[model samples]
Target: MLTFDIENFPGYPQGIGGPEMMVQLREQAERFGLEVHDKNVEKVDVSNRPFSKSGLKEKNISLRP
Candidate 1:
């Protein structure tokens, strides 16, 4: 699994929407033979060392400290 911690630039400051930025990122990733998963995170569990996040599409991702 690959994750990108991109900077979120709000509004059209540079003539790009938030979703459009994600789309561009996905496209760029695909150009490099990377598979992108379009998932919107709905829940996050950061109470412990190993954090877990779940997406609205039923994807459960984990992060270890």
Candidate 2:
């Protein structure tokens, strides 16, 4: 599990704890069917390959090195 210290975020006058903030964020994202992964993406290839939905050039991506 990844943890973050969110003392700098707004709405917490006294600064919210790290674990608590992570839990709240995770729950909110879950409500929208978002899946969070803990793996580190070590590499990315951004070479021009295809056009995106907006008709702009985009790159094919590969996460692993």
Candidate 2 clashes between residue pairs 3 or more apart in a chain or in different chains:
none
* Local distance difference test, each candidate: 0.68, 0.57
Question: How many clashes show up per model?
Answer: 0, 0
TM-score of 1: 0.36
lDDT of 1: 0.68
Against the true structure, whose lDDT is highest? 1
Off by over 4 Å in 1: 1-38
Q: Write the per-residue lDDT of candidate 1 for residues 1-65, one digit (tens) a residue.
A: 13334345555454555566777778887898775555787888999868998887586777654
